[model samples]
Target: MTAPLRPLVRIEGDTLVVPGLVSAHSHAFQRALRGTTQRAAQTGTFWSWRDAMYRLADTLTPETIADISRRAFEELRASGVTAVGEFHYVHHQADGTPYADRTALADAVIGAALDAGLRITLLRTAYARAGAGRGPEGTQRRFSDGSVDDVLRDLDTLRTRWKHHPRVRIGVAPHSVRAVPASWITALHADAKAHAMPLHMHVAEVQGEVDACLAEHQRRPVELLAELGVLDARFVAVHATVLASHEARMLGEARAFVCVCPTTERDLGDGLPDLTALRDAGARLCTGVDSHVLSDPIEEARALEMHERLRLRRRVTFTPDRGRTPAEQLLVDASVHGALACGWDVVNGDRETSWRPSTRINLRARSLADVSRDDALDGLFYSGSAACVSGVDDAAE
Candidate 1:
């Protein structure tokens, strides 16, 4: 019997074709907070920094949201990100009122992603209370959808609107254990499972969150979710920065994904994640540009390896037993694993179609000029920057 034909391969000009980077987590509106929130006195801690973000969140209207999202998504595409998982929570109008359409803000964000020529997974977030046992106050009003039924209704509308659009999809995000009760998470998880959607949430990003969860539930954040039966392959825990060893093992055993946003973690003083522990527990890793602190996927990938090196005081600490180099592994985290976390079928679907949103790197860029074809991936991650991203396919939109 004849072997099946492989897709014809081609190399054109000085370009290298690779899987496009998937931004597994992003808060696109926070892109506007970059220069303005850098004052030392205002952002000494994560809570303080959050205050600054809240201020910005209050000022966004549907128009401003679309503009900000378009600009941020454009920047992401230019930096080699072909798909984005937008963890959007700013849902209601100011003063905690729903817009006439209910999904007005969500529509703006999705339109922006389409206009900017990128695939989008809008992880419409459910932000109920301000925190555990606290009421929605001040700017928190904008993020709350009132009830789980309200959130599910809005999600149904969004799903119907984008059901036929290939470049757009929907997912569920219970903001965090801090923002919602355990009941809300279980309900959202059930809805997510029924619809076969991806479920993401912030988990153990900082010590304060862990402390709050422990005080309220007698368990760490991941432990609570695990007990609720929310730990599974379709679940993605964004910013699993402060996980205990056993929690890491639980996530790995459940085959869940942990998305680390390194630059934002550094900016917010969130401690580096226990990379070795998570890997040893068999957890797959992915990266994101959470707060738009930076939009470079290559830098995010490099930072993951560099942070591990700094923690362990050794070079190339993330090398896997499968014999792939650390650079290769990091790239996979940025691209393939990221796509998986965004609910893209990267493993079993047609490469060209499933990975509709793809990016191309310029081998002729100044940073990569001296590198040979054999060392292209290494050179791109180590020495190259987003400036090395030449063109992204328009098919993603």
Candidate 2:
């Protein structure tokens, strides 16, 4: 006799089957900065904290980067993040020289993520300058490829090497408006489009960056990016906290994704984003644990909602779009949209591929014990923590 079919939605023990969380932006090596840079007197501002980060960057070698990145990816896995868009920028040997392999540091980072059992989208970043007219100095030396052609060459090599990798994908980043000029942005965007790769950039993360972009480009960061033809559905604007209403509309019209790192933004004293403006303007939202200040995806989602409530002085600041509830909306931001930001395709099926990593939650945890199926997501986003994620499974792509 044939056996009866099992229910697809059955409660398997105490686990909650949900889509895996995605970290849309990350600097895995910066995980080391957690306890070291939190001191009050030293980290007076983001610029001050960056000095400490540069010092740490100067100390990394392939071996050390591998070790630290492995631990960081492991933490992300334990916190229910099955996929990450690692904004890897540290390149070259100390003293501004390229390694023999050219992509050695990037290879180490990808190896670590694979070792930690997480899907990785290595956002190969280009750093051509320290600022508009200034050359790279100190730790910044390690990040530069000297010119846009060099950056494209490295990306081509990386893509060819990982062309068959199931859990590893490649994208391009221009670092930031300060780190690259208009010509570089235009060229990189063209390259990304030619390859059909996702593109990301740090846009208006702080007031100083905005002022710099305005002074150097005669326009704000987003405005300059739009003018340069860099805004699009595949573009992700990281930490867009200082955007103007018109800028929000521009991003929305392009259907670009805005990846907000709430915890890290708060830690660095970056102002909160205008969520209402962005939503009304038609932009999609995603979350990231940038800087690894907090590795929990649930906490990141909660912080996004809390920050909105605080800013608007009202409850339920973010409403559901396309028939989802507020809690569901937040979860989608943490998972589905995040995958999209990282260039992952979310499909509905049991089949697993590097482009389709999945994550499940623990329904048996004390925090979720009394939650009904309908209310489970609400409990997780509103009152739960990463500690409630008891198990994480990764499928080889």
Candidate 3:
């Protein structure tokens, strides 16, 4: 029989100490759009909301992105996210021109994360055309690259520059099926495998993108990825809101991770994913604070179960097949699974992985006023908010 998961959660004094939370996917610059995009017309749908986000993306400079990212990261740290996967795509200038240094914006973002005291995985995104047979339009130009080679070269550059940094890891992200050609996905996967790096991609975030993929590739998004032979342990399919049951099984068979950004997905009116399908298929689950719609890692992780309960009209969804309890599973999804998705687990040789940070909840917090020690984790994850988190307890680390 397999041993149970260790270091589940420890209660010391009036605090509940757990592994530092992980936000496996983030778009830090979108923190600026939080209040503005909630209006009636701006949030009519995911596509309409994209219009406002695109406008905000165009207005950013290295200076502004740094400021925005710093604010986002600081809040994330305070809320118990010690590591983040910044799915950074804004590479060039407004008119699709590369900066003089080429890595200027990414540098700024990495610097900002460090400043906020968080380990960051810059998932440098690759955007090619706007869609099938179309060139990038408007703000997408800022995110697009000329060729697959360019993106790979940028990865090499980033790897070399940040090779020695203990807290920084670099991964490649193909923006989405609608943003990159199928050929690029194959090349990107090859490059990532050659380098032993993680690969992230936006998959099935919206029905329109899936429809477009079906129209062009004659296959669904995940099916195309499967045919391209990119599914692996290092592959992270983000915002997989509309995947088929078979696709979930495919990801499970490969031991791949599906990162659900519940706060951002619900905020943008995108549908929730099939959690039951993913879990039953054996796919690893993780969470992301995507779009900065909300910055609660606890909420993000709790939503995995809470959302499932609401969807299936059940109380608790996950069974302890190998004796990993539902709350323990949620903690895994919040912390280690997130770190694994960011290439933080096995990618960093001899370095600490997901266990690097530990956060504690204030037992005195109103959220846990009457909670027993055994149920503190459940209270922290479900009823408690980030407000209940006092801070990261570095001494516990």
Candidate 4:
């Protein structure tokens, strides 16, 4: 698990320049729920936290959502994130009605990211129901679509509107098995294929979701997607925390991307997925800032290894897979894999296009103050924070 680290990280003057990071699965609006969900409350369940999320979702207007999203995107930019996959689902008014301009909310989010100097992939989501035989009630109505055509129409509108914008990409997401039915998932997958778009979905995030999915579909979430022929290289499964080893095998066999949000998944009491199994079988890994619970991409990347260590109760769990050191693989998970999951090409850290920005780590920062040249990357990765990001390469657009 050791190699010369020049290709992944390079020391230049007092900074370590590297590839820009990508937060592949984000709900920009959930940034508002950061510390609020941490306090000791009576309802400590994930469902209860989700209810709190619904309340916040109900309160957002185009202007307010724009302001909040802008703030979140700015924070991500400062944290060395060049691109984001915003899994935006709030589509209609609070009362389950469409606005005069149907794409108003989506436009607001995109504008916020652009204003914050970030390359954004607005993963427009298709949500239909609360559960099996249950209509979309409460704040979910705002996320619901009457038909797959309606969802695709809004996506088409978004694509046309942002078509020529260099920093913008439009992708389709079927929210989850709970919020969306089987038919919609198939249609959304097909639509993404037709457009050659990045396809992301909330897979087995929590135990309750897996249980409900099993009861409804007689299969796990990944199993259901496989059964429907939706598992492929273009698919990105978000928060695949609760899964069988065979499920990981399915995703790996397809060379699909698993976008893990360790910070957010741990925050919500979601268990860890067998990342070793996934990697061994063939799936690529990526990182996300799902809840903005914390905004450190380094911490996010490092936690994949740390959490695995905790789960397996062993040190240096998996051997390097692709001639990369453990630190280098984690950096790829934090940067290159994320961009690729968002359907962007990445060769190395030097590229600085609208969506392909470079990142620089401050070698002089306290986190790596006395580190030797040989171990600068290891120290920066394992011990550094977003505060170590040099100001010159902070934001990207």
Candidate 5:
């Protein structure tokens, strides 16, 4: 045979580089909860784990949140995430009172992202507590607003204040079906639409939330959202773990997006998302490292492909008639589309606003010259780990 291959950097015009990745649904604070929360099996289910999370939440000052977010964002960038969507809900002080500046916590998070050089979309959350129509639970006290109106007002203030900022975009999030009343979701949906902002929510994440919704509203969470006219193109339903077959169809029909956090779901025993079904039904798919348990975009993209592989017992689960390779299709669906889920541009060399940094995969200059772009991308998605990611930064776009 011939001699072995050589690695060289391939350049058609500028350089061979994939678009930077994004974490579409990050809870910056949850980076602290990974190993500590997972190792303790004594606490079961999302509810029990909430207690541990509550203690963690109670300990954060705005400064501490900023520090932790900077560190976390650094790790994310190093692992190839150039942008983040922070689903931030911890707004007020521990006693449910607004901080002196009101936007203190949100500002802290945005500052942290800018410090770490990652683009951020702050999805400020609306938390209207559930119970006997009373105040927030003792642990959740820091996360609530008196009403959806209060939450909307805070978001408006944030938008007005940060509209001119380059790296920060704002969105609205209603925490979940269990945490907020439907009235809040409806109003927030209206606010999101009027402002042309994306709406993010945790829908059907837990069985209990579904059961409670059915008991109270006579419909599942997705069904309730659909009934209330809250499901639409700008709406992103996170977890979506408990989507009914019909609800999945409806979600697709409505052109809504679904964010799957596979690592977090697996850690929490939250069950695998029906990715193939969701795709076939026409709903676009993206991923989130919800708890920051793992921040690898490759892993997230591969997890989607592999999960579908196991479910359907076939390779190339995401491949269609488009003639694109499985890996290319998955990368675009999982990474590029995921970035756009929170309104981030990829900024690759092909676009008019393409980011042209000196960064290169060096396929030809490294030990992979013979690796075709297709094979290189496949290896990147299927075989490469976070360790293979070389650099991340903002230069010019």
Candidate 6:
């Protein structure tokens, strides 16, 4: 006789369980500056806020960086983020000399993730310089390398050395258009293709950056990348807030992913992007904690939802009842594309067996179920925060 079908939850003494969380884009080093940077007197546009960032960036030693990253990774894991993409750029010494091992800083971060029991992708950044023929100015020196070739070679070496490791993966990022040249973008794209690695860049984050790219390249940042043939599915354009209609459409057509850091954007006062419009245009959207100013995925997800609400002046942005809720969409963005963006494997159904027990999510909580899976996921996106995350499961290990 066939046995009775068992319910999904196990009653082991009477405790509830849940799944793991994932973080798409994180500048681990920025965790250190959270409280200290807020007191600065200047008006806090992305550019003005960056001055504070530069100060924090200047003080990090590999040891300190590793410590902060480990702590940040732990906090993320506690919040249910099982994997993280560390968008790292602080490479080399203050004097701009390579570490003896060259991959020293990246190694520290990877080690921190391992210690924290979280999966990690090191998106090592290639920052050539601030502008044309201008070497890195002030605190930016630590983040720059001499040539794009050197940067690629360093990444190649790091990958070769760490490719066999289980939890650590490597990807490439060209700091931003303003920091690197068009020729470098082309070459970096080729390198990304050759290595079969993911490519991420900060695009259209600030007016100054957009203006500078337009002045020098005669095209907006997104348009310039498109013209250079660098815009594609493999690319993750962080903060594509300053896009025009055409650029937004182009992102959708290219099958590119846009990572929106709503909390950080709001914190820094950078403008918000039209997420629903972008989704309708066929662009895949994801969320990022970005600056770690508020390392809560729930809040970040909410920001995405609220932006839509404010843009349209309506309530209930993500509803799974009428359709998928904003929360559900944002969760998928944080979990599914988040994993893909960071090169982590997405665990589905039986595939989840390969992942850590804590990484397996169970959406049986009232907040999750209050809106049916069929209801719009807007509530989670529009209203949820980190306080709502009870805890992840440590089941079936």
Clashes of each: 0, 1, 0, 0, 5, 32
- Per-candidate TM-scores read 0.95, 0.94, 0.95, 0.95, 0.90, 0.86
lDDT sort, best first = 3, 1, 4, 2, 5, 6
Off by over 4 Å in 6: 1-20, 316-325, 347-383, 390-397
For candidate 6, the per-residue lDDT at 147 reads 80
Give residue 176's lDDT in candidate 2 (0 to 100). Answer: 94
* lDDT, model 1, position 289: 92
Q: Report clash pairs, candidate 1.
A: none
The full ranking of all candidates by TM-score, starting with the best, is: 3, 1, 4, 2, 5, 6
C-alpha-based local distance difference test score of model 2: 0.87
lDDT of 4 by residue, 285-366 (tens): 9999998989989899989899999999998877776576788788878888888899876553222112246788888888
RMSD of each: 2.6, 4.1, 2.7, 3.4, 5.9, 4.9
Better of 4 and 5 by TM-score: 4
Could you tell me which 10 consecutive residues in candidate 2 have the lowest summed lDDT? Answer: 348-357
Q: Which of the two candidates, 1 or 6, achieves a greater lDDT against the reference?
A: 1
Count steric clashes of candidate 3: 0
Candidate 5 lDDT by residue in tens digits, 1-397:
5333222123443235665566789988988886787566665788777788788999899989999889899888877777788999898888888898998999999999988888889999988776425558886878988877788889999999999987788999999888888788889999999988889999898888889889878999889999999888778899898878999998889878898888888878787778777888878777888888888777887888887778678877765424556765665555556666786544441121222222234444343445666478766677775666666546744
Model 4 scores what on Cα lDDT?
Answer: 0.87
Q: Score each candidate by Cα lDDT.
A: 0.87, 0.87, 0.88, 0.87, 0.77, 0.74
What residue pairs are clashing in model 4? none
Give lDDT: candidate 5, residue 35: 77
